[model samples]
Target: MTYPRTRGLPTTRRTGQAPRAGTGSGFLFVMATLSCVIALAGTYYFFVRTTTGQYIDESALVEAATLNGPAERASTQFLDWLPVISVVIAAVVVLFVTIMRRRWKAAGIALVACVAANLATQLLKDWFPDRPFRGVQTIELNSLPSGHTTLAASAAAAVFLVVSPRWRPLAGFLGGTFAVAAGVSTLVNQWHRPADVVAAFLVVGAVMLPAGWLVLRTGNRWNVQDGRGDHWASSRLWALLSAMAGIASAAVAVYSLIRIAPGFGQENSTTNYFWAGVSLIVIAGYLATVAATWLFGVSARRRHAL
Candidate 1:
């Protein structure tokens, strides 16, 4: 027996079912997950293991402490209720998708991954040693993989997972921004260091990438769509905007550090390091968003198997 060919995708004579789009999205996702893990490890080592990393991190935190007034007040308020707010938003979005779209398996996978990411973060916090006194006049508490950041990023990842393909680009962008806001807020209020927030983002990415792959595989009925042009939200504009923002933030971070390099060895800073740290959080959040958006966008089926 033989199967008719469709869209240049070859099918096995025995099974007669062509692979999903003949794309290497699964390989890309696995590579992306490994990259996330490696990035997390590097972040932890540099920030917690080395004296130079410690100084830069401490400098950023100390400079942030000097910032006050309306922005600080707003960040504090946002963090004070971050847990409740994140949970409510995630729950509502997940419930609506599962009930309305009937994405039972995908929803279960997403929710499970979300809980797992948060739990892993807490465990890491407990397991990691306190910040060693490498000549930096900072606190000794181990704050890597910030809990607040994990909550926000994982909540956003959950919503991103259950949404249909057409909305993923927009959902990813909005979700990334929310997570970035939570991270920057934590830094502004001294709740966490820059590395801690970035580590949290990596943790969510590492967990959700695999879960998202599962979602694409199982939710094929709804995941199939007419591509990005089919919906305004799925427009390539969202990913482009995110990439542009990430690039701009990266440039600012490098420039800030460069300007302050000549003034280094001094014991004081002028908010340069703090802005750099904030820029890092922004870069990581949006980088993950754009990567996930592109990965899912390509990995999802363009049309159902005939």
Candidate 2:
């Protein structure tokens, strides 16, 4: 079916067409915003009304450290690797889209949005420094707005925008799941309060939703244009850059896992399970990229043959 063409943009033989808007954008924006605001409010209550910000005293830290033993180590290891995995996934999505569509602009915009979400999280943390700990205590700044969650969610949203409509729901679900998992893990490990995760979600959603909308809208506009499109001079350069980003993110995840749980790298253990999961995810991502490339290639060839 032919879609409506948007007016005022530069027209190519293929330009001016606009696709039907998807429902995902509105749904994601509303749900993400609601979840984040609720989390922030809860955090505010804890910090203002209680001593949640106080650090465990030295003696308490030593005692708890001793009692928790390997469990603490395991939790730390998981958290460290989790962010790395999220980042790698995001990078892979960016690279896949760029290579298949030669849409470097969209990929760059996604990367920037991810970075901005993290930055926004940090700024919010500093702005609201009220911890809400519930144990033997010393005093320090509160850790509201979890950066890990923000980055994961923002990256997911950005990537979702560029995917084919048929794949969007699955992409969005995976992205949201990763973000939630990262946030929940932080809380479980005592690295972040419940409130912190909520705040992070809010900050990430606020930044990503609007940014995603604009990027997708522009991309749709471009896709409508007809011609031997002007290919960007640095298309290959961008692809390589995206691959590098993916590699770097994977490395970071490995480093984080090692730092959090040194034993995680040991052979034939639950740590292996985590590593295996990440590897599978990476493999799946690459396969998807290959498929997308093949499909795009086939379509291009058919058009030429016609």
Candidate 3:
């Protein structure tokens, strides 16, 4: 029952004790969910309540709108096709899991998670209080969660959830990149603000983390894959890429936010804020993806040992 160590991921220590059911991933899921909720709440507070938040949003809109006309038009066109692209990707992943991997239970859990995330997005968008005027020229309604971003992120998350642990790292990195690109496209098209995109990432992660555990809880055998020798999809390069991207994007976001703090009300330059928003989306998307990869990777190894 020994698992070949693959790519520096965690493996079970030689102990004579049995592992508890749901201990590994269950804790991870709860923590991940709570973090997402906290993020959503904080995003709402800053984006809706604070004057600086309003200014940031206004600046983002203006900056996004000021892109070159051809680039803007192309972004809009790309965003319009995003839903279709997401659906196609999700379908391909789900089919691959169900047919090649024969992971019916995992596929079901992934789909349910996908539906729940999108439904939660609609519910939050409708029931969340409208944004106060805040003396900003932005839209009045609460667009805390971007529906397009939610669709894209959740779809990518579904694909990530159903894949085998050996493949999760690569799946996570690629899926996260796709989701982030979709979110940035929305911003470039001026279809949604930065907080909205970040919120969407949180929402998807909140729902998918638990669903991932559920998939593992029921499909332990299928979750156990040969991690020793495999394709690029099972390599650690994706983990490295995701970690580096997350760290770099987070640094940029923190630096940009700090720099823009004292200059908010002075000059009317939003380029910094715009870059900050994009950086936030990158951090959110990649961090969440890597977290999932680690969480489920541990869960799979632990369950396999048991």
Candidate 4:
């Protein structure tokens, strides 16, 4: 079965050379991955090793505890089944797409990245030392790079990489929402701090970005995209919506932190930092989705791809 090649990407003119798509994307992927790793280390250093960082992080979790009501129970229930939920949904969708599109190699690539991301998270958790007693009575269980969040984010990422550009916008949106919701749930249930979720997002991005570069290279024949307006799922509107949401959430995070800064050490938090942490997660997850979507869309175009 010959895969339909789109007239989207350019081939070598009269040279009979194979099209080189997104070589620049490869470099960008490396930079993005390095950035993620550095950010993870930074997040750990500040949130787990510093007094103020621990205090603020712990403060958010503490404030979250004060909201003792149905939300707590709901988050608990959601987290309890998150592992299974992530596996089943990701497996079903990815498997269906793989079989339908016959994207065996692409599926294999995505699977490796997914497994690698999750495995890296676990290794980091074990390798990292316990949180130091930073003047705060914090739990020193090495729970950085939360496993639940890694699972959810990687699962969503795998689906995002598997689908064609035609379906990416919708897939990215839904997948991002799932990841953000999962992260917020962990915080609500007090299972992991905000930094843990953020770290998980970074890990997934680090792994998935390289895998996406490979997908574009190996599956260039099928990765063709006309334009953002070509399909509803491929619309820039989806990206705009995600960006708008990200910007709004970022503002909320900044505002929350600013409001709590003047009296940070002295005053006990009244759900300020908690919302801030949640805001950070939302922005990170949503913005990453938007970035990845834009990268693929641009890379598939003439300037980046051959």
TM-score winner:
4
Please give, for residues 1-306, the per-residue lDDT of candidate 3 as tens digits: 675553433345665333333555677678878998898889889988888888887687678777878878888888989889989999997998799968888898899999999999999999888888778887887887999999999998898878777778888888889999888888988888988998899888888878877877776455654445357787778878988998998888777777777655425455777878888888888888777777777776666565
RMSD of each: 3.9, 12.7, 4.2, 3.5
What are the per-residue Cα lDDT tens digits for candidate 1 across 182-226? 999999999899999999999999999889888877764566554
List model 2 lDDT by residue over 184-206, tens digit each: 45544556544455566667656
Tell me which residue pairs clash in candidate 4: 10-306
- Per-prediction TM-score, please? 0.90, 0.54, 0.87, 0.91
Error of 3 at 59 (Å): 1.3
Error of 3 at 149 (Å): 0.8
Better TM-score candidate (1, 2): 1
Q: Model 4, range 175-254, lDDT digits (tens) per residue?
A: 99899999999999998899999999998998899898888877766675644466777877888888998999989887
Error of 1 at 170 (Å): 0.4
The residue-level lDDT of candidate 2 at 85 comes to: 78
Q: How many clashing residue pairs appear in each of the predictions shown?
A: 0, 13, 0, 1
What is model 1's C-alpha RMSD?
Answer: 3.9
TM-score, structure 4 vs. true: 0.91
The whole-model lDDT of each prediction reads 0.86, 0.51, 0.80, 0.85
